[model samples]
Structures are given as C-alpha cells and as structure tokens.
Target chain A: MRDGRAISIERVSKKFCRSLRRSMIYGLGDVTRNAFGIRSRSEVLRPEEFWAVDDVSLEIERGETVGLIGPNGSGKTTLLRMLNGIFWPDRGEIQVRGRVGALIAVGAGFHPLLTGRENIYINAAILGMSRSDVDRNFDAIVEFADIGDFLDTPVKHYSSGMYVRLGFAVAAYSEPDIMLVDEVLAVGDRGFQVKCFKRMGELREAGTTFVVVSHNMHTVAGFVDWVALLHDGKLERFDNVFDGVQSYSRLFLGDGDETIEKLTSGGQGVEFRDVTVSSQKLKPGGSFSLSMSCESREALEDVEVDIAIYDTRDPDLYHQATNSAFGQRVDLPAGKSSLEVEIGPFQLHGSFAKVAVAIWTRGRKESIFWWRIPLELLEAPHAAGKNLVPTSFRVKAAE
Target chain B: MPPSDESRQSAEVVVYRPDNSLRRGYFSLWGDIVRELVRNRWLTVQLVKRDVGAFYKQSLLGIVWVVLIPLITVGTFVLLRSSGVVAVGTMSAPYPIFAVLGVAVWQLFAQGLVAGASSLAMGGDMLTRINFSKKSLVIAAMGRTIVSFAVLVVLVAACFVFYGFRGYDYTPTLGLALAPLSLIPLLLLTLGLAFYLALLNSIVRDIATMLSVLVTFLMLLTPVLYERPVVSNDAGGIASALSAITEYNPLYYLVSAPRELVLSGQVADVGGYLIASGFSLGVFLVAIFGFHLTETRIAERV
Candidate 1:
C-alpha cells in the first residue's frame, strides 16, 4: 500500500479451459444447429477447467531482491507471467508502481533478420522503454554488452553466448524499478555469469527491486534476500531464503515416515523392513546414530548393509559406504532381525538421505529391504541464527 | 484513531487491474484500433518495404516490371479488339490508352485487397507477443500498394507522351486533379474485408489457400480490363444479374473515375462514385468495430 512498494499482487487466480472448440467453428449453420435444433448423436466435448495459479497474494517492496523456488509444474512461471501482465488473472488484481522490465526469456524480442542495433531498439520498446530513452542509453548498453564488432551483424549470426550477453546488458541497464528475471542467469559462460552477478549486486545497491526464479539453489542462496516456494498451484512457504529452500528440499523427499511399514512387502529371500535415526540435535556436520531392521524367512549369512548420504538439493550421491568393506555382518533368523549403525557429522546443509538395510547372499545380492529416509541438517553451532555468513570471502584494508 | 494495535496493523492493499474496456462505444473502440496500429508501425513499415523489395529484387527487368505487366495485358486486349474478338465504343482516345488506365486502377485495388487480406496472418509472429490494431495491418498493406500505384500513374503519363495522344486538357481545377479521390472508399472497403477475412483465415487456414482463386473470379466479374457494355448483353440470364453486380460494384465506380479523367478528358459521375465511397467507408468502420471486438480473444485462438 505504501508509495515506495514497487509491485503488489492481490488474491489472484487464473483458470484456463482445455478445449478450443467454441472459438474454432464460426458459421451460421453450426450456430443454428447447435442453438435451436435437436441434440445430435455426435457428442460435443466440454472443456475441463484447470487453475494454473490459485488464490495467492504478495507485495514486493522497492529495491528488495526476492527469489522464487519450486519444483517443476509448480506454477512459479505462471505467477511470474501474471506479475508481468502477460496473462490476466481470472479474479483479483495486480498493481505496479513503476516501469517494469522483464528478462522472462533471453532474446525473446529479437528478430533473426534484424541486426543487433535494430533489435536493441525494438527489444527495448517491447520492454516498455520509449525511443528517446533507448537513444540516450544506446551507447552505454552496447558498451556493457561488449559485442562491439558484431553490432551491425544480424542477430541470427550471433552465437548463443553473444545473444544472451546482449540481452542481459540491455535489460540490466534499463534502470527499471522492478525486474522479473526467469532463470536467464545460466545463459552465458562462467566468466560472464560472474560479471552479471556482480552487475546485479550493484544494481540492487542502487535501488532496483528484482524477482528471480531459478532451479539452481546455489545461485538463489548467493543472490536473493527473500524466497517464496510454490507447489501445485499454491504457495507452500514464503519467508526468508533459507526456510523456503528447506521447504523445497522436503517436497522432493516424499512424505516422511518414522517406520517403513507402507513400503511394499515380499522380496525374494530377504525382506527389508524399517529404518530409524537417533540424534540429540540435528546440526550441520554433527554426529548422529541410526538403526535399521529387516526380516527374512530363513537364516542368512554374510549379509552386508550399504549406507549412502546424498544432498537432496542435488541429486548426485555425495558419499557411499558399505558394511562388508568395514568388516560388519548381520545375522537374521527365520522371522525378524535388527542391526544398529552409527555415523558422524552430516556435511550437507539442505536434505540428506540416511539409507541403510541388509543385502543378501553373494552374486545375486538382492536387497532384503532398503530405506530411503531423509534427514535435514541445520547450520552448525556458531552459525545457528539468521544471516549466517558464508565462509567464501575475506575483506582487506587498503595499504 | 490512535496508533493502537488495530491502527498499527498492516492495511489491506488493493491492486487495480484494467479491464478490457476498449469493448465499449464507437470512438473509444476506434481509439483502441489506432493505438494498436501505431504500436505495430515498425512491423508495418518493415512488411511494406519487404513486399515492394521482393517484387523487384530478383527480377531480370527490376522496377520496369511494374509498368511492363500492365502494358502487356493492355496490348493483348487491344489485339483482341482489332481481330473482332472484342468490340470497342468510339471513345475519344485509342483503345490501348483506355484499357491501360483501367488496368492501372485495377492493379491498385487488386494488390491492396490481396495484401490486406493476408496482412494479419503474415505478421503472425508479432500477434503472439503483443495485441496490435488488427485493422492497421490492412491499412499498412494498402499504403504499400499506394506507393506502387503512384509509379503506375507516372507510367500512364509517359504513355500519353510516347503515343502522341491528346493530353486530357491539363486543368488546374481541384476536381480534375483529385480524380484519384474515388480510390479512398475502395481502399476502405478492401481494408474492411481484409480485416474480417484475416481473422477468419487465422482460424480456418483453408480459406487463405482458396483466396487467390476466388480473387481471380472476382477480377473477371469486375469491369477491370474491358468495358462494361461488352458483357452486359451476354447469354445465360445470369448476365443481367452479373451486369447489375458490376455496375453497382463499388470498385467499378472507383476504376471508372480515373479512366474518365484520363481517357474521356472530363470528370465522371462524381455523385455516384461519392455514394460508393461513402458506403465503402461505412463498411470499413463496421469491419474495424468487429475486429476490435474479437482481437482480445485472438491470442487464445492463435
């Protein structure tokens, strides 16, 4: 409501129908037959209505850097389009305070036949900059983009890297009050990305508000101040950046279960049953104890257990270890058996998998039962509260 | 109210979203049409330039191709007249001169109509990004035709000098000089029909493919290359209806005015042409109004 706030979305929802039949057949014969006559044998398909963005509201203050993070099909892009006024919401409203600049898709306004300079004017006009404004900033934009020799060449001739560089340079220098960036930072090479990150930081300091949506948690963690997580057409969590990241990680972990009773039963010879973790405090890089249980119809010998820890934010397995390599064995009789395991200091900050269970008899080595339990690692002792400083930078005084 | 807990609490903020309000009244609606057209002016200019450029780009004769096509068509018809395959009225000027003027005016109408009809579908990429004035695309196409038509007019003047024909009494009177005035209404009618067909073509692509054949038949129906009297008395009772259609056809008046000015050396039935022009203007306005009503939904349909 305040004058300084740049953008506000209030109770907005959007619905799209599945069928386009009504708009397709436009003739007097069809209209008369459908409107006044008896029903025909051929069935007319009714369109199914689906809500792309459900009732949601948020306010973005001037100069604030906000990030939106969510899984695929989570309506993040839908919300961004509504913010950009590309798609109107079926209900509620959106108010924008100043000139809005969108880098929704890089090179979106470019024409293949037009040269770089022509595209700059056309693209800027499409982004809501008048011709006079583009004229004043033309030199600065070209210089910042650094495509000096290629300025007159057609955009189709430019490399993908050159295209993204020019697009970012034009958008960043527009001095917009609100910028909506949709995962375009991953466009250029590593060095250009670093340069863009630095430029964005400077723009933020000079009072430009940005709403960035990205699947890359590392980029979101480094750049944004606040984050909102959307899932299945609804906002799941909106708060500080770290909490939103945590909620996002949890969604990928599936519903949490203390015991593995819901897992389907009946494996070949060995049946893996349950998993559990015992910890005094769940701090990052801290020690914890784990226990696992399995049942076999017959006694099994030389059984091994494999435990792997993976950062849920990233799908790559970070650490994997097996009990057979460590000289440990499990003994199971006909009905039930239990094994105790222990590990220290979880390294990853987001979500980690605590998978452990018994693997049966040699070559075949089928799993009796396995557990894919997820555990969250909070910031370690001194790094407990809000705004934990990253360990990457060091400041020095001038000589 | 003091700054108590109730007062200090955050106020409920309201966001104002603009409704599709261009859907009301004639002038307000026309304003939207103009705004949409102006927004796409760059695209319009590019399309116009591309069209004119493409006509001359790879041709062996280049720009001369513009004058050559009409001259050849007129020459063939004049040969037909000499062989008794066609009959000519004892007009003041030679038959070639009369036929060539008719071709020039018809070319303007034909190019404008064909280009206008396809303008929307041609700029399909621009339509997806932003909503522009649909009618303006048609108008821009007509503007492109006008440029070429001006070249054709100059060619007609050159023909008069080369053939040693009597100059159509070079008069400074505004009415004689404004002989091209009749084309305005024809342009409007072409633009109106183009808007309606362009929208239709977007939905039913088959219409676009069939349009050229339809246009060819319409050209034969209009008295473009020949005089109306030749076809007025033909057989198949349909000729009477067809003659009435040609006589009342707005484009007949449009083509007749320029022919009257150049061939007969006098002003044609000005009142009749004016009425046709007015009627065409009304069609353009109605077409634009209909286009504005449906444009908002175009994005979804496309």
Candidate 2:
C-alpha cells in the first residue's frame, strides 16, 4: 500500500511488566488514560516495567519473506505482533499497509468444537478474506491441509497436527498482503512444515509480504531474503539472510570473539566489566581459563560470581555452571577487580558454546551484573578428561 | 482483490525506535472498532456456529436438550397448576401456555447475558493469540441460546396449534405477527448488558461467576412462572416488597412485557415498560463504547 511497502515499523517499542497484579493495574491505568485522552510518560522505565521491543524500526516490502531470529524473550514475537497491529507501540509508529494475516500461535483463533470446514471460513474471515475468496480456495486449502474425512469433524476431535494444518491452510489461503508467523510453523510435523514453507514461497511469489519469527535456524535459513536479528528488545541487525542468519547464530551461541557485550544488570554501581574466554581456538577437551572482572563504584564485600556455560545453539541446553558444584566467593574492591575460572579438561557435546556470567552479592541472592557471550568450542580428537571446570573465577580481589 | 501470484518476496524496512505517541489518538479508537467489527462479521458467524455445535456435541440428548429443558421447566408448572397445588391466578389463555411462553423468552435473555458476559474471558485462549474483534465473541456466544430459542419457538407454536384445536384462542394474531419485532427490545437489552458484562468479566472474572448465580436468582424473582403479583392488594412482607422491586427490573420489561404483547396484545405498565426499553438501549450503546474504549488494553489483562 505504501508503494510496495506493506509494513513500515519506525522506532517502535513495547513495554511489558512481569508481575501480573502490577500489569493489571497498569492495564487499567492505560485504559483510563486512553478514555480521558492522557498520554503517560513512557520514556523512563516505571517500577517492574521493561521494554520488550525498544527502538526497533523495520520495513517489509510486498512479496518479501523475512525471518526474525533471536533467543527466547529477545522480542521476536513482540516485533511480529507489532507488525500485525495487535500490539500498538508505546513510543513509535507502526504503519502496516494492506491486510495482515497473522499466525502467531498455533490455531490462534480456531474453535475446537467447529468442524475443520467451518473453522477455515472463520479463520480466513478473521484474517481478512472475503467469503468468495474462501469459497474459491476452499478445495485447495482442504487438500493442502490433508484433513480429508476430518474436514466435517469438530476440530477438537482432530489431532494437534490436523488442527495446525487446518489453521495454517486457512491463513495461507487467505492471501493477505502481509503474513506474520511466530514459532507456530514448528508445531506442525516436519512434513507439514515443509509443505507450509513451500506454500508460503508460492504465496510470496504472489506479492504477499511475509515476516516470520522463528527460532528454527534451518527454516529461517531456507528462503528468507533478509533476517532481522533481535537482541534484548533491540534490532541488533537486519542483514541479508545469509549474513544476518550467521550473526543471529553467533548471537545465539554467544560467540564472543572480537565483540564485547557489557553485562547490564550487575547491580547499578557494580558491573561485570568484561567476560573473557582466554582461548583463540578452543579444543573441546582442551583446558581454557574463563575470567570475568566486575567494577563497582562502591566497595562490595562477600560478592561471589555465578557463571554458566550454554550451548549457544540452544540457550536452554546449559553445558555447565559454576554455582552448582564450584561455588566461590570473592570480594570486589572499590576499583576494578577480576576473577578467572579454569574450564574443560573433559568432553563437551557442542563445539559452539557460550558463557553467561553474573556477579552476585548478599549471600548470592542478589546479582549486580549479568552478561552472556559466545565461546568457540572446537571438536577435540580425544574425549578424555576434557569436560573439567576448574573451580573459581580466581580474580583474587586483585589490588 | 486477491494478490496476484507472480510478485517475488521483497525485503522489509523495519526501524525500531521509541515513543511514537501520536498514532493511537483516542478519537480514532471508535472508528477502528467499527472497521474491525465489519471486517470480522463472518468470523462472528463461524464462532456462533461453533459454539452452538459444541454445546450439544457428544451429548446423549444432543439438540433435543434444547426442547427438553424448556419442556421440563414448563412441564413442572403445568403439573403444579393442574393438581391445584399452585394457583397462578388467571391469564388470557391457559396459565401453563402463558407461563411457558414467558419462561422461553426469559431464558433467551438470562442465558444470553450469562454466556455473552463471559464470552471474552472464556475465550482467553483465542483472545490472547488472535487479532479478531472481541465483539465477535460476544455476539457468537449468543448462538447456543439462539439455537435453543429457535427450538422453544417451535414448541410454542405446537402449543398454539394444540390449544386452538381445544377451542381456546391461542392462534397467531396480528400481535403474534409483530412478535419478531417485539423481540428486538429484549434482544437489544440483553446484548447491551452482554457487552458490559463481557468486558467487565474479562477484568474481574468474578462477574462471570456472579452472572450465573444472578441469572438463577433473577429468574425466580421475575414473573416468568407466575403472574406479576397483585400490587393493589396489601400483600405483606417478601411478596409485597419483592413485587415493588420487580416492577423496576429490566428483565421484567424484556421477558414479561414482550410475552404479554405476543400472547395477549397488552403492554404491562406502558410508561414503565417504555422507560425500561429506552434505558436498556442507552446502556447498550454506552456499554459498546465502553467496550470499544478498553478493548485494546483487554488482551493484555486476559
């Protein structure tokens, strides 16, 4: 609608609170403010409030399939919702031209009791398809969904695969100018997912814009022209798919080489100044010293560190942790101080892993600094004692 | 028009920034809601069909429950009146038929409100994940009630034919021809309350629970089973005070007045009934606007 640009999101930001009670109060306040025409000061973070998507500006031209790649809670889904016009930005402008067909979650609006045949019409209509459009594409969608006899059965009785297949079918058939998909594509079995991707590629050929948010690297890498990499509510990079995806993979693996990621939450005055994996090329079973130095404006006492190593490919796949077996306490002087922990004389499964380091105080209950960075774990020829994590961030309150 | 199948995927120009305050101006909200509802009309129909289908699916009685529930309710009253256990005074026709018609109309209002009020909250799964109009869910929740109301209408019609054979004047009159028009007031009143209740239900959740209890309590208090109490006589205690309070209930006008107009062509308390209808309509409009005002924020809370 905007001369081939179906989505134009400029400096968009959305904030969310974790506490349900506070969120409800904030929700009520927002509604009241909306009614009385009052705009709240949103630039500053209120208590328990954090920006989900901060200063993110992205545009999608018609007929383009773009992948949104990021770690969990990095605002990929939030950005997709903004593109779909479901969540209005707190601070910026999102102008989405033409109709948007959003399949953010699996079977988002599908009524389980409705027959697959009936649900297709409803889901299609919800996605902005006219009745005739559904009628024309009805057979094609059913065939694509492959819900033959189940077409007349209530979707509740159908398997989850059938549900997603029908849901995706209706959405794809709706043929919106822009389609927003969030991890929902992964819910369908691999075969159906391939079919969906193939179908989406064909749809893209038809002038439809596609902005997809997914954690699956292979799927994101498949056919997208560009990949927007999100990190902590910010659009870290929007690069050509190949390059963008590589960076996204690095961002995920916390592949800390030449890049420096300052740990933000190390309690205001105290911060994890830098996290260093002292190995240029890490052999999986080889020994390496991992060190983190925290600088505090205040002289912090009894401040221990909590560090974890994770498979960057999968953040949830934590390879190791310092707190669990090797708990150490260190004192940080008023000025900058450092600590080092020896890692790996034993085997590690992944060749690419990252370290999440945090500085905690008050009996390890409070953390002043936390940051994650990428580490390169090379495949070792021998799996012999390579998995050893030498105890302590040996920073020794260095004077 | 559907997009042509030849254009290739184009790159997106996404710019993430802070604080664009001017886009969501309060004035545009109503316009956006109206636009969304219009776009979602078919979604509303589908949801309604889904709801109606779900209500009877896998049940032994199935759609028969639609006719059976009303028959049992009216059947009890018919038995009570026949055995002289309960004297419901006099009506233009048989008391059982009059009572049955009133109960049928009352269920539409009571059940519609109970269901419609909770539609949004009950649809938390869909509401959170989907971008369709919330108004569609509220309207769709009425589908179950509508299905039963249709069955009730047929049953009422059958009663009229049977009574007519017995030489009683239960035949369709000019008033009966206007029955469809007469139902508009009741439907509007119930739907209006539904908009408010559905919105409120999403916020507090207790409203949904409260409504089921409230509907049951109000059903007995309303003149659905018996005639509107004789206010002229000095009826004492609960009967006297309850009659006075019931006089003001919106449901009385919706259920009692409409049934009266259909069955006997009489308006019960013309001024009071007119005022009630007008108030219900006004509330409905206000409730819709209230819903529209808060709908954007609703998804977050639910």
Candidate 3:
C-alpha cells in the first residue's frame, strides 16, 4: 500500500437479491399485506441473492495498459464500474490512488433535453472537471468531436454517431491518471475506429494507465501490454497480451464451432463432415495444399461444388473455383458417397480457411457438405517484397 | 553504445509495473469532494437555473405568474373579508398587505422543504457517477428558492408603491439590520429536514407523494394567512390551550419576526426570534446527521 500502484482490488464480491413474485401481485399486495400482520409464504419467502462479481483480486500499477477480454456478460463493465467507485462491493476492499476516469458507456450522462454545449459542461463536471477546466478544454473537445453547428442543439436531435463522437472527445481529453474504456471504439466507421485506436495509443504513451475492455482481438493484441480474460463473472486467465489472446481465441473458436454445428443441424440439411490441409514437404514460404471431403445420403447431379480459400489474417478470399467451371460433376451413386477436393501453392504466413461445399437446386438449395478446414501458410525464405510470391523463378546472386 | 545512443535506447524501453497503494487521508477528503463538486458545478447551476427559468420560459405571463399567484390568493381572502364571511381585525397595515407578506414568507419555507427533500433523488445520475458533498445538493435547491423569493420581494415592494403606501423606513440599526439574520437558522433547519426526507424518499418512494398531503394539513396548523393572536382572542373554552399552541408554533415566530420589522415598523421580537433560531438549528443538525447516515445505502435502494 506504499507504492505508486494506481488500483488494487482484494477479495471483492457483489450480491444482488431478486424476488420471485411478479410485480402486479407482489408490488401492490406486499404493501397492503405488510402494513398488516397477515403473513403468506410467497410474501415471506426470503430473497434469493447471487454474486454478480465473485472474489476478484488484482493490482494495476501506474502507466500500465491492461486489456479486459471476454464474452458478453463476463463482468468486465461491472469491474470497471467498481474501480470508479460507482458501485460498492458487498465484501472486501478496493483502493484507487489517483483520479480515475471511466467511459464505461459513452454518452451515459447526456440528457436528451440539454444542448450539447450545456451537456459538455454538465458532463465534464460529472466527470470531475471544474468549471474553469471545462472552459479551458471546451474548444479542444468540440474540435475533436467535429460537431460545429450541432453543439447548440439538443443532444436528442443528434445522430447516434454524433453522440458517440462527442462522448469520446470529452472523455479522451479528460486526462485523468487512470482511464477505463469499454467497447466504445467499436462505434462509428472503420476509419473512425482506427483514429480512436491511434489516439488511445498516443494517450498510452503519455504515462496514462488504461484499462480497456474490448472483444476485438486485433485491437487488444496491438494495443495492450497485458490482458485479463473473464468468464461468467470470474477472472479465468490473466497474462501477457499474446498468451491471453491465444487462450481466448482457442476458447472462442471452440465455442463458435459448437454453436455453428448446432445451427447447421437445425433444418439446414448441410453438414461439415471433415477438413484437411497439405503443403510442400519442407521449407518456409513454400507451397501448400488444402483438401475437404463431404458425404451426402441422396444422389446429386448438376451440382456446383465451389472451394473458397481465404487468409485468416486479412480474411480475403485469394482463390476460388467451382467444379462446374473446372468441368467436374458430383454424380453420387444413390447411397452415401464422399467427394474430395484439393488446392495448393498457398503463399501466406498465417492461418487460412478452406470453405468448400456443393450447391444444387434453386430456392431450397441443398448443401452436399461444407467444411471450414484450416491451413497454415508458411513464408518462403526467398520471398522478399510485399506480396512476395514471385511471378517467375529466375534468380542470380552476386558471388 | 555511444552516450547519446545509449540514452535514446533507454528511452524506448517500456517498463511494465503494478502499483498497489491507497492515496491521501480523511483530512483531505473535503478537497476531493470540492474537486468533484467543481467539476459538476455546471450540472448544479443548470438544474438551479432550470428551476428558475422554467418559471418564465415560454408562458405569455412569464415572471408575472410568480407575483400573480400570491396576489390571487390574497384577492380571494379580500373577497371573504368584504362579504363579511370572516371578521376583519384592525391592523396598522391594509389586510391584503399583511396577508400577502405572510404568504411570501410561507412560500420560502414550503419551497425550501419540498425542493431540498427531492434534490438528491432528482439528480440520481450525478450521485452514481462521482462523489461530491451532499450539502451542495441542498444548497442548489435553496438557491432556486432564494432566486424566486427575491423576485417575489421586488414585486411585493412595487405593490406597496402602487397603493400609495410609503415603504417602511429600513434603517441600519443593530436590531433592524438583523432581520435577515433570523432566517439563517431557519434555512439550516429546512435544509436538514429536506436532506433527511430526500434520503427517506429514496428508500420509501411513497413518502414523496404523501408529502404534499402532509404539507396541506400542516399549513392549517401554522398561522400563515391569518393572525394567531386574533384566533386566541376569540376562543371561549379552549382559549388558554389554543394560545399556548399558537405561541409555540415555529411558523408563528418565523412570520412574526419579518412582519414586526417590515410592515409594522417596529423592532423584531428578540427573545422569540432567538428561541425559534435555536429550535431550527437543533432540528438542522439532527436532520443532517440522519441524512449522512442513510446516504450510503441510497444507491442500492434507488
């Protein structure tokens, strides 16, 4: 407790009590019955309380950038609010050493009836800025928000994007010792999102401690030094950014496949049976092969079997071909039969997905099978330039 | 590495560390509260200004409504006096003037009580975001009331001129100058009661709705529109008990002090004012203490 660490939470737990009775009966009947001594089982039933945030212990030092990543309802926002002292935990202690700034929900303090200019002052004050401080920073906030004419108009009339921009501008310029950002960067277009991340990077360099919660793995990987993964109101893993992301991706991808399988079985008739990949025996940046097989019970004809290969890093479909275009057809013999397809010379250094399937019949098109087979493309040692796979193999080195 | 290059290399190396300590203490708590309040001063001013501005925002009558409502109330009482429905007492000033002054002072107490009680609950958003002095909330509510009361005072003064009645000679005497001084304790008491009620209303929402009903009945117990002395003189069987009740009534003394100095052109009742001030101060301290005790749990209830 004597060091310059900015935040510390020890054995914190919060519980909320919920009643089982409906509002119509319980709300009105409870008032009347409780006034008298008439006790009923439903009225006297003790409230069932569950801890929303379980025992969580963590320490954040000054000038550290931490990323919070998890699925929705993982108590990330709750923990941020607790750090800001917005909600007190039922048990344990939290100590914050400096001025804490939180943008848990952008535009949370904006009133619909108030004009943007008025709301700036009001919201600034709510964020712990004095009147003089707001006056000094007002121009910069407005400039960053880029809302010139709308500043004097009621915020209710502004578009959702404008609300987010204004909220972000005010919060970013607040310049507190510690800042908590929660999923606000996902708002607006891709360009604005990039600008926000860049600005956050600048702030991170200026000795500001940042606790960011985002589902965007790329942003988390690029920006944060450390990451904490939460699951079902518990901190599942806390580690360096790369390791945390790897663990998260594995958990996320595993869950995603299970959920996708569930959706596909629900009256889609199409299923992904198996998927596999191949590459040149050895050497980095060498050619690679991908293969997928599908089996169907019914015999199919005049089907278009398409294979789409995409680099997971860029998520762009680099190669695509159909069996019809290649003069091939799937004429299965009545019962279940398998179809196999292969591709090669994969020239990427990241994971690639092999999406293959056969499409037949209009309106109620039946999928013979689909597979999301993964392929790892290695970089060739000789590949030097951007988009480095050479058009012709003719090389001479000075000896 | 060269000296300059070594320094440049050191600058690029990022250090990752964690701090785990609490800063400052209770004596500096007030500074933190002040900083939070200053940051949110805009919200406080806006809320206070809105309460004042809404009185004259869009209506054709605008600010006149403030004067007109009390004037109309006095007009109704005047009609009752003219029709002989009620006996008129002989006084140094016109009956309407006396009645209107009583109404003006009563409005201060009522406004202070209602607005102060509802202040924190009304600004629930601010309460959850940052911690500030709860006293500022009461101050904002009182500020709104004071603004309206000041406007009303000017109107009351103008009415006195219109009726060709010379304004009471207000001099800078030790006693006469202390007329405004009497209101301090009363203000404190109202703030305390208001804070207490605001906290209570958060826990028991029904209290807010029931307050208006309670206030209406309480108005009868206070001698605001009519003179308590007149009622005491007329009572036959319960005269002593009725007079005792009227003597001890807090509002009776609250109204009497101002009326004595301003309209009647006499020194204020010093003994009566002091006793009332003491009572108000006592109530204020108790109410504020109760409010602070209950405030920690208000967010959960709200």
TM-score for each candidate, following the candidate numbering: 0.71, 0.75, 0.72
Please write out the lDDT profile of model 2 over residues A1-399, one tens digit for every residue.
366677777787788888877876776677666544466555667799999988887777767888888888898877776666556667877777666777665566676777888778777766667788999999999998999899888888998778878877877777777788877777677788788878887777666778888777667777678888898998965556656665655553454464536656567677664566676456645666767676779888776666677664554755546454565656678978887777666355334666666667767667677666666765432121224343446556768
On residues A308-360, what C-alpha lDDT tens digit does candidate 1 reach at each position? 76654457776787776777765566677776777755655534444443344
Q: After superposition, how far is residue A74 of candidate 3 from its true place, in Å?
A: 3.2
**Residue B151 deviation, candidate 2, in Å?**
0.8
Candidate 2 TM-score, C-alpha based: 0.75
Sort by lDDT, best first: what order?
2, 1, 3
Evaluate candidate 3 by giving its C-alpha RMSD to the native, one decimal: 9.1
Tens-place lDDT per residue, model 1, B21-105, is 3323456756766776776676565445545544454466765877888888788878887898966555665566677777888
DockQ of each: 0.17, 0.22, 0.13
lDDT of 2 at B72: 86
What overall lDDT goes with each candidate model?
0.66, 0.73, 0.62
In model 3, the Cα lDDT at residue B96 comes to 72
* Fnat of all models, as shown: 0.11, 0.31, 0.08
Summarize candidate 3's per-residue lDDT along B1-302 as a digit string, tens digits.
Answer: 01132232223211111110112333354454456456556657755655554445446586677678778878887898889886545666667767777777776777778887777677676566554455566667887677767777787677566555455433334544555665676677677678777766655666667777776566656666666654545567665664577778776787667766666545345677778878988887666544443344455445
